[model samples]
Target: MTQELGPLAREVAMSYYEDALPAHDRFHAKRVRDVSIRLANECDEPVDRDVLSAAAWLHDIGRPLERTNEIDDHDEWGAREAAALLEAEGVTSDRIEAVACCIRTHSIRSSSPEPETLEAKLLFDADKLDAVGARGLVRLACIVGERSGRTGERHAVIDDTSVFGTIASDQPDISLLRKWARERLDRLYTSPGRRLGESRWEFMEDFFAQFDAEIGVDGKR
Candidate 1:
């Protein structure tokens, strides 16, 4: 996405996106980059614009290849793969490694509880914030679209067994994702994220509430 990443790296990055990306990889990554910039400003630490920005963009490079496409155990592949891609594009060794480390450790299981540097903290905060609300839900819809997913009867909650079953599903439930997102909302780390994501989450909550009202609980009618 930059002239600095050079011709080869830029070409590779283009190739990566031309082929389809998992929902989070496509939309959420961009969203994270946007938020990471804002977070970088508020924090006391100094974020490496090149490192953090590149990492943010490439963080999900391995996602399309993963069997589950779940966040679990995903960071390493993305990190290693991203490092190779970046290296080919002429990114500096230290910067490349730093970006790769952030990518590799972004998963809940893989991530350190603490951000080791400004880039790490900014990336970490941004990625987590991506899961919080309206944007996150829209990103999920895009993922479903990649699978050509069509819900049964116009609004059925599709799961892993469904034609476009979510990768998270050894069996995935659309409702389950909504529930999990609600839980993760409480996981936002940075101050800006806490404030920024709240309204987004509240909007989503209201949308679902109206949806339930329309669906008619228990179909009692």
Candidate 2:
């Protein structure tokens, strides 16, 4: 699998690195791939490794286009783009279709059909998992920075000019978002996904609690 895809997927992923946001770029795809593979190994049902691997790498390839409004739906565009890329890579037609399906429905926000196959579910789980952990906090920070016109390196520390710093200063609002994150943890599909999410979810909860206390908004507000 490494010989066949390790390089190609990395190359394909690099195409998005320069254009996409730091949080959702090639590195995000790699995290999803790692989590997806782990879930696939722990799944109760059988999952096709090739399809999952390809889909994980290609799933967010269309994010740049979506952000630019070149496509209204990243998932749809990603599915089509992934299919074409897989075909060009000499992957089997059936595998290409399966990979496309995984990309099409991996998004929890999109109107695309829910993940039906084992591979799709695992990919979905892996992808969403990144949005809830400590990684999730950092990703949220990047998003906040982007919205506030303060975009910079992925791992920048929080500051007044940064989004996370703004969030830290705003207690009541951040509390609401923390509530939303807590609820979202229940939405994980696969058992392994949920199992993995538990710790990340708790970590977020604890972080926010500490955040509230440190910021002097622990109980009153």
- Per-model TM-score versus the true fold: 0.71, 0.81
Model 1, 129-177: lDDT tens per residue? 6766776776656555555453432333453244443344344446754
Candidate 2: where are CA atoms >4 Å away? 1-7, 148-172, 217-221
Q: Which pairs of residues have clashing backbones in candidate 2? A: none
Backbone clash numbers for all candidates listed: 1, 0
**Per-residue accuracy of model 2 over 84-137 as CA lDDT, tens digit each:** 776677767787788889989987674778988888888988887887879887
Best by TM-score: 2
lDDT of 2 at 52: 86
RMSD, one per candidate, in order: 6.6, 5.6
Error of 2 at 207 (Å): 0.4
